[model samples]
Target: MEEQRVNELKDPSASKKDELLKRRKKQVGGAQGDSSGTASQGEISPEEAAEQAAVMRSQIHLFWGNMLFERSQIECKLGLHDWKKNLDVAVERFKLAGASEADISTVLKNHCSNEEAAAGHEKKVEDPISNVVDKGDN
Candidate 1:
């Protein structure tokens, strides 16, 4: 009976394909929490809207690139040394591409190593006790 039930199950790929389709549909329909409408709904004039859009776009670009670099650094600190080097290279690329020092620092704050940070810098890990498991047989 179990074998029959398993055989009767839908193909995993089909569900995955459906999920991809749904994601595409959502993207096309202006995904939830998207501020495109909110930006347009304001009493601001078209010129103001255009300026706001440009500013938002710039912010998003910086944010996305920073996120990628910081994630790479975290991966490196967790023993992925190669990823760390790659992230450093990416940061250099950003600097060469004219990314502001403030932007770089803000993004890196979350992932910097003790040695990478200045004196008196420390990372505080919230919920450290959650990592401990009580394996005592009671």
Candidate 2:
């Protein structure tokens, strides 16, 4: 329901949110959640795994990313600087959503890494400061 609302309003600027929305189009389940655990329990297919991964990544992104979730009912919003705390809550949600243990494991990597951000500021082609003309001198 929350995701659907997020999807409907659709803040199209953020790259992370864009990716998350794209994944939502392909999300599994009957509008419920994710896939369940193991072959015995119910093995998650590749597509389901991808969708579940996206959900985890999306939740983590929303929590730690630049976006403010003041009205968001997402569980991760309460998780501040605590990736484990966020992951724990997300895991339980996914479990209830029917995500398998292996599926959860696949998305359990450190989602808080800054690798998504650029390594350094992109240098402008020409330094604008250097091009400043001294009109008074002229």
State, as a TM-score between 0 and 1, how close model 2 is to the true structure. Answer: 0.25
lDDT of 2 by residue, 50-88 (tens): 765765665554344222222122334444465445456
lDDT of 2 at 44: 52
**Which residue pairs come into collision in candidate 2?**
35-98, 35-99, 36-98, 36-100, 37-100
Residue 37 lDDT in candidate 2: 31
Badly placed stretches (over 4 Å) of model 2 are 1-80, 113-138
- What does candidate 1 score on TM? 0.36
- C-alpha RMSD of each candidate structure in angstroms: 17.0, 14.8
Which portions of model 1 miss their true places by more than 4 Å?
1-43, 85-99, 102-138
Supply candidate 1's per-residue lDDT for 101. Answer: 70
The estimated TM-scores of all candidates read: 0.36, 0.25
- Cα lDDT listed for each candidate: 0.52, 0.44
Candidate 1's residue-wise lDDT over 12-108, tens digit each? 1233345545655665456445765553222445664665555455445444555667678677668776776656765675564446576556545
